[model samples]
Every structure is written in structure tokens, then in C-alpha cells.
Target: MSARQRNAAFQAFSWLPHDLRNDNAAVFAVRIKDLGAGVQTCLQLIETSELEREHIRFDGPPAEGDAADVPLLSVTDTSILLRLAITIAGVISEQAEQFCQASEDRLVKARSAATSTGVDHE
Candidate 1:
């Protein structure tokens, strides 16, 4: 999937409660893969406490290389997967808003052009 799609999927999956963040959650093993390419990045959620465990990855497509073998997220560790996820979601949302703004601008320009040319828009 595209990075946008992957980001979207991650955002959707990350919204789950701490208890349901495991593989048993609605969307488990969410492999975003290659973010931009279709490379698969798998997520293996393990529960330890309200917030502590490993988000392991047995396979990470290829772009990730050996880093995929490492835990992608873990409250036990110092890495900020949860925080990163939130940041990614914010970035994705901003990008979406920008895309919508650009689209609306294009439509406005098109409408203006049509009016200037006396072309029927409807």
C-alpha cells in the first residue's frame, strides 16, 4: 500500500485501547510493509501490562532490512512508537487537509475559467 494508506491504517489501528492493542484486537498484525511501495511491515502486539510489551516483527518485507527484526514499539523500551504513531497520524491528517485544500483551489480555478469562457458548468 502507499505511505498514505499505510499511515491511515496505522492511525486507525493505533486508536484502540491499551487492552485491545494486541493481536486479538480488531486489526492485528497490521503490516504497513513499504510505506510507499507494497513492502510489508508486520506488527506483533504483545500484552504485558496497561502499557508495557514488545511489538515484534518476524518479517518486515525488505526495505526495513534487519531493523524489522527489532521491536517496532515497546513501552518497556525507551523508543517512542506510541508517540511516533500519534505524530504520524497528525502528519497524515495535515497532508490530507492540504490535499483537500489543493483540490478545492483547483475546482475554484476551473469554475472561474468556465465562467470567463461563458461555458455551462452544470
Candidate 2:
């Protein structure tokens, strides 16, 4: 994913409820660069509804691993958390869009001033 996407994810994750956020702060505080990786590995089961219903199918007994290492949250609870994370991400994306537009406006004004001042290209 793009830096913007990861940043949005991190921002969203940070906006969760205090108790839950604190409980999972390590995962919630994941670095911007690690959002995509973390999501794929740690939260893959929480994929979009379409993907979950269409692509995910279980046919055999579950494999055993380090269950103790995993969080004990139920699917409903996990969905709520993921929803909050995505909402925050959307906010971040909107803010970035605004910032980019403002930056472009400033650049345009700066270029106009430079041209009007008889600045020459090298």
C-alpha cells in the first residue's frame, strides 16, 4: 500500500476507545511503514465482507499454533475495531487531499510571483 494508505490506517487505529487502544496499544501504535504488513498478517481475517464471504472457506480442522499469543476478541468486537480504524483512515485521506490542494495553490502563487519579478530560468 501507499504511504498515504498506511498513514490513514495508523491514524484510524489511534482513534479507538482508550481501554481497547491501551490494551492493544502495541498493535495500534504500529509504525506508518508497517501498516500494510501488519494488516496482512495480524488482521487478515478481517478482510472486507465481499472478500470474506466469497474467498474464505474452511474445510478441515483448524491448525494449531500459539493461540496464547493472539488476542481473545470475538469476531464482532474485532469488526468494530476494524471499522473504527478504517473510519480514521478515511479522515486522514481527506486531510491529505486538502493539504495537497493547499500546497498546489501556494506553489502556483510562488511561481507567479517569481515570473512577475523577472526571475530567469537557468
Candidate 3:
């Protein structure tokens, strides 16, 4: 999956449906911290074994002038803060929808397989 898809999957799995329904700084900060930990865990897993590290290469950090080195937002007004919150809420809502759809699809596939094999998946 692409980075965006991976991020969406992480968000979907990390936060509950109710958690993603809010978009305040405190909630966002917690989500950011959790995502950072998840990313670090994935990196550590990738580097765990010598064979995997040798075959799978990761690029170095971004250069000094890159966007990653810059902060994206600074809120000086309530209106701007409100807009930011709305945008975050929209993104999180979309991620939740995607998660729900994927879950339903998986459930359908599992049921189909169980029927074919004469097994009770429930």
C-alpha cells in the first residue's frame, strides 16, 4: 500500500469510532503520538533481522529544505482553529468509513468461505 493508505489503516486500527468523532488538539495530539509509536514499531520490526535489513532498504531522512522539516500550521485566530478542526474531523471521518467498509467486506468473504467449507465461522 501507499503511505497514505498505510496511514489510514493505522488510524483506523488505532482509534475507536468514537475517538475519531472529535477533532480537538488534545485528541489530535494523542493520535499523533500513537501514530509515531506505531511507525517506530514498524521500523524496528523491519530492522529486526539481518537478512531482512540487507534485502529491504529505507532511504535516509528528508533534506533540510524538505516539507517534512517544516511545521504545517500555526493558529492565531479562533476561525482558523475551527477550520483546522473541521478539516481534521473530515479526514478522520473518511478513514472511519473506509475501515467500516473493509470490515464488512472481510466479513462477507469469511462467511462465503465458511459456507463453502461446511464450517461455522461465527
Candidate 4:
């Protein structure tokens, strides 16, 4: 995802609740990143949608009074959300780079095999 898309996703997930973040906080346990509960909640929502679905549904529009358990994504500071967006975007960029590298390697290997086999290389 580009930075634009990443920011949009971060903005979208700002409604994530507290428990969800705490549940998935272990993902970053090996690493040390001091993220707020609200930001962590949003990250969890993005990383673990299956568990998040059980806690918060997005299949359809929420009903009245159904938002009782929901916590604000960044109630105190939009800056938090922005910072998290940058972090999330960095992760996405790394993944995309890896994927692209794999794709290029596959392409090179395929071409090499085709040439060695004397097949009609395209």
C-alpha cells in the first residue's frame, strides 16, 4: 500500500476499542514500541480482523447504542493516529518490498528454466 492508502486505513480503524489492542499487543512484544492503547487497538483491528470481528462487527452498519463497548481510536490526539499510520505504512512497505523481490526472483528462475529447456520463451 502507498502512504495515502496507509493513512486512510489508519484513519478508518481509529474506532477500534481497548480490549482488542491489549489482545494483540503481544505481537509487538519482541519489539519495543511504546504505542498508546488507542493506537494499539487500531493496530490490532488491522492485524487480527478475525478476533476483532468477534469483538467488533463491520459487516454492516452498527445499530443505535451498539457502540457502547467501542473506544475512540485517538480521542486525545490525532497525532497519535498519524504516528501509528507512519509505523503501519513502514511495515506495509517492507512486506511489499519482500513480495516484489520474491516475484522478481520467481520471474528470473522461470526465465532461466525456460531458456535451458529450449522452450518457446515469452
lDDT of each: 0.45, 0.54, 0.54, 0.55
lDDT of 3 by residue, 46-112 (tens): 3344333333335444567765522222223333544555565566666567666867998899999
Model 1: residues with Cα > 4 Å off, grouped in runs: 1-79
Task: Report the C-alpha lDDT of model 1 over 34-66, residue by residue, as the tens digit.
Answer: 121221111123223212222233332436445
Candidate with top TM-score is: 1
lDDT (Cα) of model 3: 0.54
Best of the two (1, 3) by TM-score: 1
lDDT of 2 by residue, 1-122 (tens): 35687567454545445445444334334433354454454355555443544333432333576233233455676687677667656655665566568679977888888899998543
In model 4, the worst 10-residue window by lDDT is 25-34
- The lowest-lDDT stretch of 10 consecutive residues in candidate 3 is 69-78
**Clashes within 3 Å, all models in order:** 4, 0, 0, 0
lDDT rank, highest first?
A: 4, 3, 2, 1
lDDT per residue for candidate 4 within 39-103, as digits (tens), equals 47666654454444455664554678776544344333444555676786677566556656867
Q: Each model's TM-score? A: 0.43, 0.42, 0.39, 0.38
Candidate 4 regions with alpha-carbon error over 4 angstroms: 1-76
The parts of candidate 2 lying over 4 Å away from their true place are: 1-71, 120-122
lDDT score of residue 36 within candidate 1: 14
